[model samples]
Target: MSVAVASASAPARKALWKNLGVQVVIAMILGTLVGLLFPSFAAQLKILGDIFLRLIKTAVAPLVFLCVVVGVVSAGDFKRIGKVGLVAMLYFEIVSSIALGFGLVAGNLLGIGQGMSATTAASGVKPPSAAGAPHSTLEFILNIFPDNFIGAFARGELLQVLVIALIFGAALLHLKESKRLPIERGLNAISDAFFEFIHLIMWVAPIGTFGAVAFAVGSSGTAVLLSLIYLVLSFYAVVIAFIVVVLGGICAMFRINLFSFLAFIKDEIFIVLGTASSESVLPRLLEKLPTYGCSKQSVGLVLPTGYAFNLDGTSIYMSMGILFLAHAYNVPLDFSQQLGILAIMLLTSKGAATVSGGSFVVFAATVAATGVLPLEGLAVLFGVYRFMSIAIATTNVIGNSIATIVTAKICGEFDESVLARTVREEMA
Candidate 1:
């Protein structure tokens, strides 16, 4: 611990992009460049990319499960669970609706996917059997609670994991104090350990990002880039507009400023963009929430719930994408039918994965409900959709951050003084 020894260690500790988030970004840029230079090797790079993602995905179910359980059980309140749950569901519905509207407007204005013939490339791939489909609302509800909890984990079902976590957490709260303390402590320890493991694994993110982005760019080449570039740009534009206009208006109504708020979390945004998942920064956000004026209860309640529910970006992408497919096939739809799409989006948007390309399955449901063009039309856009995933993913992160802050302000949990201080730093 001598000053000389500390000084020597400092330089070693300062890695090339010492920040995991920064490393991830550099990896992405380098990966893309490599892909462009060595197109033939792109397929091998994809295997590398898939490995990293699979690692991340494997951890997701456990992470969410433990976090939710620890978050709720640690609150030590039975009634607040119901209260916070209601707030989360309401927030999800309202913001997701706005996102859907934005996508609807953007698709109409841009006229993407318009005037193209339906693709027949996927005609041979049979759809999954109806036995596996959630044919009714009741089936969807019942399927959420798995008969075997371990089976849910094995299957990697996010909604099922969430349900199990919430129920277990609630049951823990009802236990006697003597029994509850031991259980809560053990669960919290496990949650903390898993998060630590994530931090350790994050050291590899920069490398993973490089491989993933490079593989993507190289395999598809500029053809994929050019194909979806417009859609990507338009989607990003819509998200930015939503952040500035809709969320900004919300900030103004509360006498807060959006730019300043975003500035406070610039580092976090960089991390999300590179990693393409906001879940990576959930712990940091929770720590910073108090400084932003949220109460312990509000931060604990709002943030984790928001992850599952208030995915504004996903909602927008789902709506816009469906329309994009509709347009590409020259399928004419009346205004009433378009409105129905929005309604359906409202229901399906919540609980979608925060992972890149996770919305495709849910997108399949919306396509089915529309009863418009053939489902195979989606395959044509599949190649480019991967590139667009980052846009919606970024929007999802930004939307959740804003929602948590705004909700805190509404609940009188925000500290005006802290908000001013944070704003000053952001503006500077």
Candidate 2:
């Protein structure tokens, strides 16, 4: 009996080792050890991460375009699309504002940077210039309308692609079924191909995860974390609170189980943790959210738009980060000033999803716009930024997932029974 049990268990153990999540966890551990042992060699492995990100990015533009177009066309009602967009934007604004306020309140209460000396701010890395500052509100609005249509996809500009897809999809809505069906079929075919490509790219995820984690640890070393550990811990705590109290409440209102929801997407969550890029899992969420009972139309529209406009996690980081800089620099900011920062963040955060290094760029731009916090203070965060980014990316993915489901419920497009059954099967 003992021998037979051992024989049966061997294959189960082998299967567990073959699981992607297990592989990623092992890679992260190995990467961390290698980074600690041989910093220089680990840093050289950064190319592996860069390659993985590049491949993921290659799929982003086409996948987004295809999804948005398909979603809009399938909905078959421009009025409904308009309604979904309005509700989504309104929800994003309210939640994000709450997030910003929560972060500020937490920062004030915790006093995270109170004892930190600004002398260490001189990290020799120059602060980003105001010249390359994020777009002003007017410029951002104008920039959404691409001057050249194809140029948008060629450049992989998300906002631009969104605009084009909206217009193209709406135009298709005006066409007769006979005329539009062929185009829809073609787009669906292309979308499938892109997803397949994503599957192939994902096989390299563990390798990429290893390289990325190793490089981050090797390049920065654990010493950086020790110095800013308080700020890091505080930020993480705020994020957790937001996820539980705020997002959890939202889930409760919709009759969804937050823990079950997390379990349903555990694979994607782990991927985001390893890659530290939310866009890395965008396609997967688009494919899976519908299976969780959100209408495909809602998943397609809300998820992508939420990426751009509904960054609850980023809002928390920006508000808290600004306050931390102010405290470290001994700069006095009254209630009105903090309110001003929140207002600016409302605009700047919208662009966070579309740009590279967006959070930092937006941070710099906000600081410059306010002209209160010292630009040098930005350098103080350099060492711990990568670590913070992992949390930010993970939270962003979770937040967007919830936003899609919530929007679906509000729009009367969700089936709770479908969600319950799907969650049970996935969890089982």
Instruction: Assess every candidate by TM-score.
Output: 0.84, 0.94
Clashes found in each candidate (C-alpha, N, C closer than 3 A): 5, 0
- Model 1 regions lying over 4 Å from their true place: 1-16, 115-136, 278-300, 354-357, 412-428
How high is the CA lDDT of each candidate model? 0.70, 0.85
Residue-level lDDT of model 2, residues 292-376, one tens digit each, is 9999888888898888888888888888889888888899999999999899988888877655576777777777788778877
Residue-by-residue lDDT tens digits, candidate 1, 1-428: 69988787753444555666567767777777788888888547776656655666666678667767876776677666566667666776787788888889888988876644433252232433223434345656676677889988877776778788888888887889899898878877886787676667666666666766776677666755565566778888888888889888878987767887787776667656655665556666665666777665666667766776788888888877887877777777778988987777766665365222366556666677677866776665566656666666777777787777777666565687876676565454
RMSD of every candidate to native, in Å, equals 4.6, 3.1
lDDT of 2: 0.85
Top of the candidates by lDDT: 2
Pairs of colliding residues, candidate 2: none
